[model samples]
Target: MDARLMDATFSRNQPSDARRLYDDRAIRYDNSWHPRFARHMVELARIHSGERVLDLACGTGLVTYPAANAVGPTGSVVAVDISTGMLAQAKAKQADHKHENVQLLQHSVTDLQSLLQLQGETFDVITCVSALVLLERPYEAVKQWATFLTRGGRMIVDVTHPESQISLITFERVGRKLGRPVPFYRVPFQSPDDARRLLEDGAGLRNVVVHSVSQMDIEGRDDLQAYLSDIQHPRIEQAFTIGDADRLFDKHITDWAAQSLANDDIKQKARAVFREEWVKLADASGQIREVDEVFVAIGWKQ
Candidate 1:
């Protein structure tokens, strides 16, 4: 979390790292935070039956599978990702769900133009969700992706508000407490204007529109803890050995607690206070609630 450490982590945001990280995470990625917003993107795109669709960075087929269903068997979906692990999982899901309209491809977005040419294809709808920020030059990438769309075809891109998730906030808080800086690898697309500019101006797409969607969900306390525990923070493996990092984190928490509380009784009281604060985060379901905002940008190929 030190500046140098953070920089090192950010440097690993290349295609190779993404492949390895996602390969390890393919089995669990769908069950994680991303799929929650994937459905919304598919819905917003309004993919119609018989339309040809391309799902870029289609991790575990979250958006791809749904889009296939929306388009029905008459349509087709080309789902591509850099990670073989993710594509494998997606293929498995595609088989299990019987989404015969979907096809899987392992290619980075950087190579999409050439790949499309090799396949001699174009699409009616092109979607890249929660993965644009990972690109080194999102503007250029968008521009390239747009070239693959048919005239009047729609291109949809979505990104999360950088600070909107509870897990992110918790990581930042803990980092600050320990005098470390939590690093974000993705380029921040934190506002609607950001999305608009990237699409309409950067990509030269016409009739661009951006929409913001907010979702709140209640999670059980134990469930939240387990979720946090499994978080493989970007480049975390390079930072510290597995159990060592958790031990260091626990020590920091202990030190912070000791400095803030006078005795065991006060420490217990402090714990209760924090627990109530967390509980207050819950919605009517009496589960810990986390609120997040997702921005979806739509543009048409002119």
Candidate 2:
């Protein structure tokens, strides 16, 4: 861990805004991404019939509903999250699916102990999707979940690749071209190794398994360039602000559609600069039209 890394507690203590941010975006969350991360969650959990499942930070029920289907009518699912609006969406999704065995709990991952204790039950499998970046204490949060896990139970968490989640200011631009554009990434850790160590070893899981897969390819679309531009706009700030975020986001798309320029030329020059240094990044990212996804990380708690 870097000595300069921000304290893990910062995310947990001041999560209200962040919670609402996801809540507000819940409706469009699934549509924005190119890949189906829920499939990765199922693969990591290896969900079985008749087993209880807990989806921590179950935003808008993406993984929750699939888990319910995996377990079927005999099994039950407890979906937990910090956002009430998000929970409401999840509840609505469950109703839409007519899943009688699924339960939605409004709670943060940090409060898993109390939530589980109140239910008087432990889950056979726990899974999370994309909410890892919003957590304040990733290590403590995982440890708490592990403590509550059944003897053979395991947890599967999906988060944005840390390497992809770098500061917006760090990218290098080519002359008259948008330098190599970087993917938008969330905080907590910058590398999978760091995530594994913090969530598994530091958290005291017996045997931790880590797998990484890509989620989206930003190349080939001028719209994507606009998408990235809108995210950083002063009035928009994709993941941060509330009002007009979508409007600003739309501006990126709308403007890109109107502009007649080549992004491939800029990208190619940037690729030349970092090709050897960022071979893995090059392989992971491709055109959204040609590629299905960017990357997904699956961690198992032993």
Candidate 3:
């Protein structure tokens, strides 16, 4: 197929930039620290042999493949993700590991009927890692997920701390202050209590366990410079995130410009404002502080 035609077909199939962006960066993510995070999430979920597992937004099979191994041959893992590109990477890994118990499907969480058909069928464990905030309706999604769990079965999900992605959090604050809020594709939980409530009250899951692990570092000059470059990337809309923000920022001026959210002139102005604000916030506490906080929660259906 012609490149242009292929690109058009892809666009026709996956119209949302949110999906396309992950598809575009699947390779890079597979090579990043996310795999470690997935492994850790799987461990925390404590998936057992002979148990059925459903991994949501499986993403490059990070959580999916590991959970597959945990479940072993007697068990099965059905990994679902919205991005075919991401699933493709997971499928490729599937070949090497050849976990015959693993099944990969491409479907959005909102499409319940086409997802794992629940004709009295339920999983022993369900895990969603590093992908809940990306959902269209997080609370509703969790509520639905709970129904898929067998009695006494558990669901594991992770949430980012408000300050986990400080760069983006800071950028959003700057944008809001500038009266130019660009929806940056995240819904963060303000605290551990918020996460616990979401599982207990929102999802109606019992025995909710919220474990948060954190790390902090003083931001050096090099680190701040790198962050600025990320915020300034032209195609940031396509590639903004928190991990490499070590340098990941998406002050996506171009996309916003095309959509008439802001033009080049305003973007330039916003850039200066963001930098100034960032510097102040960074220095207000002496040295800039970089923080990472991730919360892993487990809840039982019964």
Candidate 4:
């Protein structure tokens, strides 16, 4: 689906343009550290054989495929995402891997309860990775998800720590440089406490547990250029259409350099260094080493 259709479909109630953004990012979504995060979320969810699983916003089936394998043929996984592009990629993966147990659906997470009711199905394990904060009504979505869980079933959600997200960092830095707020990158659940409260109070689930995990060591500087190229190209293209993104990015680096260096000449030199070796800048600033602080929240239905 193209951007025009996506916009037209969700135009009436477009508080969040996630569908369009994710549709644009669908092809390269897993190129970054997301696949590793998916594997970790699957492991943490402890999906067992013969258990039914629900993967909300199952972008490209990163978590869904792994969960399907863990559940084996006796089990099934219902993977749902709002973006058609993301679902298309996920369906292709399902076909390639012959994961008959996995089912891909194009639906918003906010409509999950209605979907579950229509099918009259419940899940032993429900997982939503890195997508909750994108929802228009995340608390309501969690409440709906809780209703679809079987007794004693677990619901696991992994929210990315804003500071650990390179995309958010870049957006914030650039937005500051432009002297404007980037509301798109601002998410509601900023900390583990926020997640816990939403699960326990908003969803009314029991025994809510929250923890953090990091995936910094997965891909080092060797894969940096390709990774950045894959992830940033689409975003930059989407964000800046009138001007050259490289030039804007260089200005962002120059502004960033000016903060640390007192000497004007040295700051200019620093900007040059940053522009030439910007991929390595993540490593230098400890961003790559602290790539993810994934806040995981698991709750159970009584």
Candidate 5:
């Protein structure tokens, strides 16, 4: 990787789970339900012809390509993400599709002013999807990015409700028991009102509209292997119950335990509590589901 990408990766000060997802899981991202949400975020942005767009944490150009199409040759879309691997995928897709209007930047979303001020540029719209909660200072990040929006320009972002990803929730619960708290991201965007507060209070945005998609998206059960595959690959929504516990533990949780720097006691206790929690999450038919309610909020600069 180049120095810029290296800085983008190592300098952001994000949570370790962000690093795990961007570095190791970027290639497998589109396999999850993220693309669906990304499309929804852009569709709601309502970009116009000849408008400039900034897409933050744009993994593999999910939002970029569609926004590029909306902007056409007369406009440009700058898609930024911290992961070189994710940008590489996006670059390949840009090449194959011949999208000349899109620029993929391997940069941290946390620092955009210096990144764009060099060009004296501002955007008509800014988008970030499925990424805000990963930041160490998510609201501050929003306020910083909002400064790059032109007068009356819109900022669009999405955050899942606290109940969305049960796997991470359960993992963090186990972490608390072991005295090492996994980075908990469930405190914000629990409702449409929460999303609006982040925009209005943090960014001083106006006319904020919070759209609650996936409100009705209840958890559904799958086999153990399939559920593991979803979380192992970083599902858009996570942690369902059911299936073979041994395979789930060996394949996914074992690595998690190691990464958590588990002593034998921690490992054994973690496994026990994880299994207990996992079993508790399952239904009578041995299936688990996630209530992945997501809020896509759009607000305009005053």
Candidate 6:
């Protein structure tokens, strides 16, 4: 995804960035976070051949692709997002796979009525993944989405668990620096209880089931270590958040770039310092004591 596109969507238009970023970063996201999150919904929906599914905020076909596959040749997936760039990437990806079951659209969850109006359609199942947190009014969005589901049809949503927003901190060794404390992060709610109540009891969706999952990358995977190093990469100035902390220990790669390149000794020391400091921070935070949980809420249309 191009940074320009990301900035255009997220930073430029605060209200509509969700659609834009998904369009811009849709392809990049598939390799990073989409597959892991999509599995839960795909399983819950139990997409059978010939069934129809609506993937709201489908962002570059992460959930859409799998759902398309599950439904086999007979099923069709209407994957919607606001970003055309993201949809373009998804289309490119689909072209590569020769998948005919997936259809990409430029749409948002809040405008479901208009979307339905355009397509003259409804859905048997609707799924959204990690895209609801940005909604200014999630309840209203859910209520609108409810109209599209047939009775007994399912709506599965995955969002940042409220509990996942809390920060927990602690210390560990950074190379030779012993007992330096670091930030530990945790979320606040396993699920949004209030939202769940409103949708199930208030809005009339039924049989809401919230499932929690923690996909940890701390151990036994070279890929994760490489990815973590990149995430904490010095050139990246943006804060990577876990839980509700305002900031984590700074990864000031820019500050050390020149010295690190000019002197092997400097680079070694820099790596050691960062490694120990991050370890201490993670250990001190006490986040490792418990698995970080992401919530998946599944319900039937009333």
What's the ranking of the predictions by TM-score, best on top?
5, 3, 4, 1, 6, 2
Alpha carbon lDDT at 166, candidate 2: 20
- Report model 2's TM-score to 2 decimal places: 0.62
- What would the per-residue lDDT of candidate 3 be over residues 122-162, giving only the tens digit for each residue? 89998888777655467888888888889999998877665
Q: How do the predictions measure up, each by TM-score?
A: 0.67, 0.62, 0.73, 0.68, 0.74, 0.64
Task: Please write out the lDDT profile of model 1 over residues 1-302, one tens digit for every residue.
Answer: 22222323334345765675578678877766566567767877888999999999998899998899899889999888999999988888876766588888888886776674326678999999877755657888888888779998999997655435533433333433443423322334646788888889777888988776543333542222222211112112112222232343334433311222223434344444434434434446554333355667899988
Give RMSD to native, each candidate.
11.5, 12.6, 8.8, 10.5, 7.7, 11.1
Error of 4 at 42 (Å): 0.3
In candidate 4, which residue pairs get closer than 3 Å at backbone N, Cα or C atoms, i.e. clash? none
What lDDT tens digits, residue by residue, belong to model 6 across residues 124-198? 888877676556566677888878787878888755433232222111112114221111111222345744664
Once superposed on the true structure, which residue ranges of model 6 sit more than 4 Å away at CA? 1-15, 116-119, 165-192, 201-203, 217-291
Candidate 4: worst 10 consecutive residues by lDDT? 229-238
Query: RMSD (Cα, Å) of candidate 3?
Result: 8.8
Q: Point to the candidate with the largest TM-score.
A: 5
Over 4 Å off, model 3: 1-15, 116-120, 173-188, 214-266, 272-288
> Candidate 2: lDDT over CA atoms?
0.53
Candidates in order have lDDT scores of 0.65, 0.53, 0.65, 0.65, 0.70, 0.55
Off by over 4 Å in 1: 1-13, 116-119, 166-188, 215-291
Candidate that beats the other on TM-score, 3 or 5, i.e. the better one: 5
C-alpha positional error of residue 163 in candidate 3 after TM-score superposition, expressed in Å: 1.6
